[model samples]
Target: MKITKSIAITLGLAGILAFKQDKEVPVKAALQAAQVHLANMAAANTDVTQYPRSTKKDGSIATTSSRDWTSGFYPGSLWYIYDYTKDKQWETLARQWTAGLEQEQFNRATHDLGFMLFCSFGNGYRLTKDPKYKDIIIQGSKSLISRYNAKVGSIRSWDHHTDKWQFPVIIDNMMNLEMLFWATKATGDSVYYNIAKTHALTTLKNHFRKDNSSYHVVDYDTITGQPRLKQTHQGYADESAWARGQAWGLYGYTVAYRETKDKRFLAQAQKIADFFINHKSLPTDKIPYWDFNAPDIPNAPRDASAAAIAASGMLELSQYTGRSGEAYKKIATQILRSLASSAYLAKANTNNNFVLLHSTGHLPGNSEIDVPLNYADYYFIEGLIRFERLNKGLAIVSTGGFLTVN
Candidate 1:
């Protein structure tokens, strides 16, 4: 529960004192800075079909098609900016960027439709109440559920690497469930809700360790409905705890608790949060190395994307705990402040026009090491928005009455 020690050293004596005095999160300045960076990114990346994913080794922006799993994030970040600024310009740009991914509503081949569709269209619909966006979201949910196996009680994650895994389900799939929950909320059908709930329960049963940290991938046998392999495809080793995988578990379970009001999910989320926050490897600034168990400790590349996602998720998790959640909020605030600092935040027209820097995408593959990533920016903005909402006594992201649509 103590965040002041390391955070004090990272942010200097003023920040340590601010933590003691219960100071504001400085969301306005962060948001204002983000707007300028977003504008630079928007101007630089005009091709909607190719969303900015990350920077290449040669210092150029790497772009991916809408078919890429990360395609939704750029548009989703735009929607968040629009929500924060309420400017017609950002809305126009959000719509433009979002429209390119409409074809992905039927992409059932991958288990990432929720990330691909929901993050973009869901936020757009939430902000604008656009009927077209709503329809796309419902269809996208249907597509996402198509990957669900009744026997396995979980959605399949990767279609590739079949030689390695029979039915691979990665921890990142937890992120896509938020859209399914939203779908059932939008419509009165329980099919989406049931699939999502079952998936969460199945993952809850199979994913965590005794210490509450999660494996990156759990390969299930198709016939017996048992885990064939519980290993790490992205971490340092099969037994290593990947930093982003842990973030995904924390965010995923938090959403599960939010959608279902299930206390088990809440308890699981708390345990995961405790594991992440209290882990010995977490740095003084609260940003974690790409893998907690990486052999190169203290020298491993940092994943700002993981830190941003955890910050955003913990902000929401903080809201559910009342006064007991203050510590979670404070830790999340420490992460946000570190991210907003000059060390992480990219200057305008720099970092290939991306907002944040130093995210590790896939270390084992030797790809995207210490580069700017779109999702890091997305979640950093999201964390700022959530903090500002809490400051103003508003519900974070407006669930539209939780279970009821009207």
Candidate 2:
């Protein structure tokens, strides 16, 4: 058999198994494989490093490199470890990663604090019931809310550069609205819920294409509070569908539906999922291109992050709809198996740490295009946990058409 890079990588770290005549393979083995991969990744990030803010086109600090909220995924990655294992060592690492994030809490500007802190500290508090984690999440939520624009009725994004966009709203910002939802539930504050609902409505109306796939960014008229143009900044072109953006739409709408129980959100989630699953451009392993229409596929590398995020959404969908028949569970299992066996990096005691591999950051500068990504690791772990929980016969209650809870 001709072994491709993906197949070779899968065969290398974990041995392949032959199926017996009539018995189905156990899901626990796959979960154990994911756990092994997670353990290896956790061991890899022992060394401490600080990220410095990089320079922008305007000769000012662009995005902060050192513990900025925008650099949220790595710390979020640690939180996954803490959640799955309940290991003190993982907890310790999560604390160390979050200690560095304390500096950004005071900035109170960017919309990514939810991605940075909520996935880490907010999850930490929710899982452990630690007051400190609650405080951290509250502060991060406050910071996220400060970026909301009363004029546009949505959160502002991209403070650094861009002339046509003053209160630009990006599809990625949809993931951050969870902080507002959480605030409303935690503090009994309706304002946060109203704001979050408004943002979701705005995103539903503007950010999505006809096929339910989405643009990376949407320019909104700050004065008139109308959508000016739908565009893509971090994709192949302004009109193209970025794979991660699609993943965001899938996961975000599922989450929104979970929160609101809105059928519209559920419909949107299914639409995005259909677009992703039916795309012929997807790799043989069912992982996706960085951009669906990138114009250089076959040779264009796949984004494992996109696959991981989509897998998480699929598992949630299976639980939401209560139809874990062959087709639904089979695809979910296939994705989990591929990620566990193929993309996972299992080196120990190094700083080049990540779980899911072959993640494409971007293609514009040909930098970090098809490498290990932190968000991929986070979502992959979440998917595994969801699978494990479901396989154990845990009943999932659909919170809205978007989210699932035990």
Candidate 3:
């Protein structure tokens, strides 16, 4: 080897690896796996632009139409893939999948218009500067905020499932506030921004227990603007922590802190992280059971979805604090490493083209249990992209993406 460029480059790579962190994951492999998985999903669905929300037990893709809350995630994930790998095939898939949800920009009945359009069309607009996607996102934000009740101080989460809940506000609704915040910034109007802050403040007042663990749902009385019940629909009990609900709180508050620079939201996020990481039930691997209160301890189903969301949110949260932020980054790195392991990640061409396996969704309701959810895949990709952006000194919610907690 007489100083050939190939030999010099190999030595240079070795020198670079000398300072590499042990927890630094090769998420590029995950990206390649995603490309293969998405291609398979496209072929399996056959011209349908809607996303695959879950995989059936028989290994078939269960596609969700644009009306479903999870319909945006598949396209959003594809956009992240394109952003990460610079692969144009992912761009094409992103656009095609996103087109299916165009009708959702005007759907005012559901609060998930943010999840439907912001995660898909918002990302599309940010990455491509497409005016059409921007228009859709603004319209979708108006539709999402239309569900907000000033008296209740929160957005109404459901309309069809009102038999048990009136003026329902679930922890999951925290995730939809980002679209409102982005809309205010894009339009130079504060009405959407004000509604987001009010909803977050109301949730902060009522949703958290003393220990900082959050309830899954908070049902408000429509007339008096009072909380009639503080119970759960999908958690193990009225007081138990639903894993993904806590994650949604964490991600939501982190986003709010970034947008408003509020110390309360930052403190709320730190406390929620303490509750999650220091909990007795959290597994050594950092992945959590579907419910912290589940009867089965070691035998409970793990929610990789929750772990993914927390990892992405924590990455953004780390930017807000100084020394404490380093700890958050370290734990988040460990989570990424854990999620990239064989235990959580699906093998190539397996798991019906889903990225991760063994996620529990609404186990208490006996639905979507032990399945791969579209949102899980979306956040997993986000964790990877956010990590890359952090190293490059870029923003976590690249182009008005939001995160929150507690």
Local distance difference test values of all predictions, in order: 0.85, 0.67, 0.81
**Model 2 over residues 281-385: C-alpha lDDT tens digits?**
876677788899989787777887888888887777665555533344566667767776634443322214344557777677665665666677677777767
The digit string of per-residue lDDT tens for model 1 on 137-172 reads 899989999999988999999998879998998999
Model 1 TM-score (2 dp): 0.92
Q: Which stretches of candidate 2 lie over 4 Å from their true place?
A: 1-66, 322-329, 343-351, 395-406
Taking every candidate in turn, the Cα RMSD to the unseen true structure, in Å, is: 6.9, 6.8, 6.1
Residue 297's C-alpha lDDT in candidate 3? 85
Which regions in candidate 3 have their CA more than 4 angstroms from the true location? 1-24, 397-406
Of candidate 3, the 10-residue stretch with the lowest lDDT total is 1-10
Instruction: Please provide TM-scores, in order, for all candidate models, with all chains considered together.
Output: 0.92, 0.83, 0.91
Candidate 1, 20: how far from true, in Å? Answer: 20
The best candidate in terms of lDDT: 1
Q: Give the distance in Å from residue 160's predicted Cα in candidate 1 to where it truly belongs.
A: 0.8
Task: Report the error of model 1 at residue 360, Å.
Answer: 0.6
lDDT for model 3, on a 0 to 1 scale? 0.81
